[model samples]
Target: MSFELRRATVEDLSFARELTSQNMLRYYIEFELPWQDHAFDVAWSERQNWLIVRDSVPVGYVSLSRDMRALYIRELQVAEAFHRQGAGSWAIDQVIDIARGERRPAIRLTVFENNPARSLYERKGLQVQGRDECFLRMQLDISTPVL
Candidate 1:
């Protein structure tokens, strides 16, 4: 049940991409959005990413970016086999700590409207701040104590 976060490397690209596709393709289809593989590459290049490893195997990853106002979670995908075992929640807690350490005012992310992960985000204190046809923008203000 112990998990560790390791900085993702170039070699992790394929694994991250495939894990994301597996978890998200259904939503893409449901929303009628095109699956653009290059988008992952673009984000991977621009953002900071980490692999969630259990023992020695990678079970998921989280990608992040930062602005003066907040730390943004660009992507967080957990392999199906590891879901409900706390990998996702642990990642979020790590992100919260990162934001706190960086003195960011908040943490932000966009989740597909029906994605089950939304509940996990909500449980972690991120509230829905806005929404579009396909996504809900959520945020957790960490300027004050949140631990």
Candidate 2:
């Protein structure tokens, strides 16, 4: 499937908020994350949000941030209809490409400890870095070429 990433703007905030709300129940249950309206606002405003477009339609969105140390993935929500079609992987590959271009040492993200996506991330070479009560911190060192 052909897809592209577009930077999300203020116009896309409402759609993003709704989509995230609809799909975040699993994480909420697993991690006790609050589904507060302000939380979405914070993410929409602070992170580099990207709308995953396929054939001119928005299929999903991912929120990413980069600090001096690593590329931090804050959110990745693929519409249910588009799941299992590689949208998530494509989005992640985009982030990896950015990290490589910047020569960043690693990519980091927090996944709900029991979230199924953790296994997919592990398969993609991210290792468990640490964990707290609700989240598992995972890291992928990108300084070395991925084999």
Please state the error at residue 29 of candidate 2 in Å. 3.6
Candidate with top lDDT is 1
Candidate 1: regions farther than 4 A off: 144-147
Query: Residue 79, candidate 1: how far off, in angstroms?
Result: 0.2
- Worst 10 contiguous positions by lDDT, candidate 1: 138-147
* Model 1: residue 91 alpha-carbon error in angstroms: 0.4
Q: Estimate the TM-score of every prediction.
A: 0.96, 0.91
Which whole-number lDDT from 0 to 100 does residue 45 have in model 2?
99
Candidate 1 lDDT over 34-78, as tens digits, reads 998898788798999999999999999999999998999999999
Candidate 2 at 55: error in angstroms? Answer: 0.5
On residues 1-147, what C-alpha lDDT tens digit does candidate 2 reach at each position? Answer: 598999999998888888888887767866666788887798679889999999999999989889989998888888889988999888889989988988899999998887788887888789999988888999999975677
